[model samples]
Target: MERRTISVTGMSCNGCEQNVESALQNIEGVTRVEADRGGDTVEIVTEDDVADDDIEAAIENAGYDVAT
Candidate 1:
């Protein structure tokens, strides 16, 4: 599995965190997702190679920003 730590912005509460987590978890290759509101980041584990753009798009679609 490959692990990636993606910086996320615009998350204000636990609900936002959960939304981000759900978005990441829904991606095809994603095996695990950990959204941290305090840290403003999401850690993901996936079997298939995930594109950075795909990750950013997923977060953006969920109404958040991905810090490059």
Candidate 2:
């Protein structure tokens, strides 16, 4: 598995974290997702073929912004 930690913004509470986690988990290659609202970050574990644009899009679609 490949792991990536992405800085994210607009997560303010536990529910926000859950939203981010759930969104990322829906990706086919993703095996794990951990969102920390306090740190404004989301850590994900996924298959090697997963694309970074897909991850950023998932976060954006979930109403958050992935730090550039």
Candidate 3:
């Protein structure tokens, strides 16, 4: 499995974390997603190849920004 921790912004509560988690969970090959608004980070586990760009796009679509 591939593990990644992505920094994110604009997540201030549980709902924001859920939104981020839901968005990431839709990606193929993603096995797990954990979003922590308090820490401004989202951790993801994937069973196959997954691009960072795809993850960033998902976060944006969920009305959040991925920290650069």
Candidate RMSDs in order: 0.9, 0.5, 0.7
Candidate 1 residues 1-30, lDDT tens each? 898898999999999999999988888999
TM-score on alpha carbons, each prediction: 0.92, 0.97, 0.95
Error of 2 at 5 (Å): 0.4
Q: What's model 1's lDDT at 68? A: 74
lDDT of 2 by residue, 1-68 (tens): 99999999999999999999999999999999999999999999999999999999999999999998
Candidate that scores best on lDDT: 2
**Cα lDDT of model 3 by residue, 1-68, tens digit:** 99999999999999999999999999999999999998999999987689888999999999999998
Report clash pairs, candidate 3: none
lDDT of 1 at 22: 91
Ranking by TM-score: 2, 3, 1
Candidate 1: residue 63 lDDT (0-100)? 100
Clashes by residue pair, model 1:
none
Model 2 poorest 10 in a row by lDDT: 34-43
TM-score of 2: 0.97
What 10-residue stretch in candidate 3 is worst by lDDT? 46-55
Candidate with more favorable, higher lDDT: 1 or 2: 2
